[model samples]
Target: MSEDAPTRADGDRDLFDPNYRAAVVDLLGALAYSELRAFAQLAKDSELAPTLGHTSALAILAAHELRNFKLLTDRLRALEVDSEEAMQPFVEAVDAFHARTTSSNWLEGLVKAYVGEGIAQDFYREIANYVDPDTKSLVLAVLEDQGQADFAVAAVRQAIEEDGRVAGRLALWGRRLVGEAITQAQRVGVERDALGSLLVGAPGSGGADLAELGRMFVRLTDAHTKRMERLGLSA
Candidate 1:
């Protein structure tokens, strides 16, 4: 296959299965809405920037998120799914996550942009492992860092350096963010059975078993700890 084309999984016919297709649709839908919301959140958070440089950087990240949203929607259209319809089911859950985790200050917003989004991307990437190669590629592509990680880490670490107490507060904030994130994931699993089947190895679903599901969470937790440390905060 050419580099521009989505490579099909060799002899993996699960893509044609109804259950598998539904799972992919749910995955893409959740991701598409997430990118859309990330774009909105980033733009809104830009107003909290203390400097013009920070504002411009956040605007750039927001633009990247919009582009990623387009990519996901385009893929949904390719699957003959209405992008809006696919995203609708996830709107309430995703919006609730943002609402509950609203940041009170510039630093908290930055940490949410970093730690909160980081765990989400990690979770999606883990789910990608059980999906078709084409869908997996798109998931990973849309989840790309877009310079947010380095930017947030540098800005947050600098703040912590200026005030050692900043680390303590942000550490607490990071912990809460992770907790909320896990809760959101659990909620999605409960509400989206098609999507959940992808994690539990449903018949013909091409997913992991319970043991592997447990390992996936371990991996996600480990990655989140590393991200918190990068922000100079305790996990």
Candidate 2:
């Protein structure tokens, strides 16, 4: 998000421009708050776990998210941006996403966690490609899989093996998660011009075009499908 960085390969140079630097800070703040929120939700969901082992596993995942939050906030501080101010703009939309997609049970929570994280990682990674190398590294690092996938997949698949009927319901829940995510994403796009500019580029900057954004969503959806399949759920 630093304005001192060189232009990117596309010559967009959003990273080095003051206006775009604010956008980058906005993006980082959103990501930072996201990790923190996920941490809280994961901790709350752990209470629904049927076993002590499941509880401990979820707690570990929550810790990983907390660590990611710290990383993001540290970067924001270094950039001299107030992390909370940067995150403020996107808070309502993000909260609405979780509010609408709240899980009804432990299995549903697990599926939501797995699927949601997968899609989000795909998205940020796509955006990172346009950013400075250092910023991109931080974004990718924050999105890195922290052992949550294997645990969620194994737990979910084992549950389905035990009670096959659950798959149909969980599959529906998976679809619901995707739907809510898409809806919220559109909302974010409308509400955050800075973030939208990161995707579509500034008016004259020749950033990512519509076709590129389409392709990025395709990649994200494909990744989401694979993650759902791994969980023995339909996407």
Candidate 3:
């Protein structure tokens, strides 16, 4: 987390599952790290847009991610988890994932923002439900507030209307993003089994089995590809 970015402070008092405490802490920490990095990436990538309208909206959206990061970080601290320590190792994992799949242009950036943010929201929604009610409520509340996905989707749709051929490259890029996501997920499993197990076993979240998670991942990929097709972009 950036030192200058304002910390989001929420009530520390929330019911939680003691057995799954580490998983919850680590999940929030990892999620927070992703948000922080995404903001930084968007802030940089937003300038790549041709229009001030696109750049300005992305910058403002990037700022909002900081708020969510602060909220998640504060929650980690309240749980007596070391926010920095928990988030540290993941910095590389999440950052590397983004670095490897960076957008080549503004439209690529927006498409990435759309597909990436949507999947992340879905993943978090699944994870949050498995935790406790307070954590669930807080996570759900935060989920409701993310506008980046909406903005990204709209931006891409508009961009597609301007140039139809951009779809093939962007769709390919989305596939690459999905590929890296799966690779990093495997990395996460090796690095953090407990969290992975929680993801696998926590009721209906993420997966009932590895096959289920695989199925869900394929669904997300197909949805992204469909998004491309809908935009007059070829998969």
Candidate 4:
């Protein structure tokens, strides 16, 4: 099997369990909404580009996000879940996350696009490990990085090189974005029991326990730190 393909075990058959199915639906719904929001936000942020080349790059990234959104919603439909209805529960929390982390300028926007989204994708990828094989594959595919990381890193690093002061300011912004992302993630897990149960381990849910969840956060933090380093900023 390809390295990118999900490893299948006999346990993957648990996908048919009603509880596991519901959890997968909730996961797909949340992912679908996130992709849609990314598309809109990337398009808006493209307006902050300093040059036509930057503008075109961000526009391409925005298009990728829209395509990813369609992939997720299509998966939800195949499960017989109403895409909009499934996504509705997460709208408020996700919107609030963006509202709290709104960027003040082009560089800040680049940092958020890289750091904020990176942490969220890391968290989802970790969770994917606990799901059935097919659901795991879908989640991994949707969460794949789509060139935004490289673009953001190059842009932010160049800015920092041009103005040393840019590093300090962007470091602070990166910290705020990570904190807010964590808070919003916790809120979602609290409000959405099915999603939470995937980590907390509902009966027959085959989810990770509390210990695993703690370690998951550690991995997330490490990833954020590396991302910050790539941007020429502190974590």
Candidate 5:
């Protein structure tokens, strides 16, 4: 990941670069909607919780997603972009991802929240490196991993400790989540040129080459694996 992002010294000139602006808007929009959907899904999944304590924890997690969604939407508005309009292009793809990865049980839902959200955050953080400093800061801020890691690991490990059989099923579930996430991401890459430009360059900027993109994938995959391991689940 490049830390040599254009500083404020580059001034507003780069901000006015149409391609960069479009790409950033597209990125923000996709993130905004993803957060929004995560909140909705988390809220719904909270109902499947076995106890009030678990339900409350899941609701808190949903709130975190909503907060990130608000940050992204606010950024979009500051750029004079309609948040909904910007997110429109990604609606179907994101929706499709969640639809295909729906969980059949409470533990599966938790695993999805842990593994799926972790992967999405990793991918966005990777792309942030290629963007300007301001955008990179916002992306990083919105992606703060929070305390979900500890919660996921404790809950999952406890479940596995109680019933060793669950480990095998959840390991497969984690793999399915990774696969579906990759499928949707590739679909979006092919369908959204603006988002794709983040990897290959918008127009003027020398964006990541094929090798760089490959490395980015490796980073995301490695991060996902670690996240799954943290949850006591297989990647």
Candidate 6:
């Protein structure tokens, strides 16, 4: 904690070891896959929008996602990691999660994106702190919400203002998404221990209590529920 002493990231003197590279590569690949899938989901979800403006915005946002996907994938290739293969392992989990909680309406889609991406950003922000300086910055930089949560929140708010009746269904939809998302996240944990160890931070790293990963997940869900409430959706 002192400026005089060099900060210790892990027990190893070199933090950029093979395990770290694997973790970094997988992490980047995961994000690239996320962007690609979000592009498709956004396009589909945008169809539920009654307004042309909202729908067009979704298309624009989807473009942003593809652009990001390109950047991340390029970085993965530069690192000599097979971007597709790195992303393959967790694809089923993510795909199943999205499918199980597919949104039925515009507000539902926005709520899911806003709520889901918010929680994911929290996890990524924590991960940004766990890695070495370059990777920490990279992680922080990739934690994107500009084209997703921010846009979705405004659209949802405008929709609610225009049609107050949507509150009931969107609220229920939000809750269901929160539930399904955590379910998928738990499944991801079982399947991807690296994430739990990294995003959750290592057990002894002077970071957060890795043992409290479950509690942290619960806390994120709780906060997301509060966001729903703030958006006029009951928990």
Best by lDDT: 1
Model 1 — TM-score against the truth? Answer: 0.93
Positional deviation of residue 198's Cα in model 1 after best superposition, in angstroms = 1.0
RMSD (CA, Å), each prediction: 2.8, 2.9, 5.6, 4.1, 4.4, 5.6
> What tens-digit string does per-residue lDDT give for candidate 5 at 3-65?
543344643336567777788888899889889999999999999998899899989989999
Off by over 4 Å in 2: 1-16, 203-206
Q: Which ten residues in a row have the lowest lDDT in candidate 2?
A: 4-13
> Which numbered prediction scores highest in TM-score against the true structure?
1
Instruction: Specify the poorest-scoring 10-residue window by lDDT in model 1.
Output: 1-10
Report lDDT (CA) for all predictions.
0.86, 0.82, 0.69, 0.83, 0.83, 0.69
Candidate 5 runs further than 4 Å off = 1-13
TM-score of each: 0.93, 0.92, 0.81, 0.93, 0.92, 0.82
* Model 4 C-alpha lDDT per residue in residues 83-194, reported as the tens digit of each score: 9999999899889999999998999889988899788778778767877777788788888888888999999889888999989988999999999988777776778887
lDDT of 1 by residue, 83-189 (tens): 99999988898898899999999999999989888888888988888887778888999998879999999999999889999999899999999988877776766
Comparison by TM-score, 3 against 5, better one:
5
Tens-digit lDDT string for candidate 3 (145-227): 46665676677777767777766777788777666765665565447765675657754333357787777667656765665
42, model 6: CA deviation in Å? Answer: 0.8
TM-score of 5: 0.92
In Å, residue 8's CA in model 3 sits off its true spot by 24
Which ten residues in a row are the worst by lDDT in model 6?
A: 1-10
lDDT (10s digit) by residue, model 6, range 124-177: 555556666755665666665556766766777777898898877788887777
RMSD of 3: 5.6
TM-score of 2: 0.92
Clashes in model 6: which pairs? none
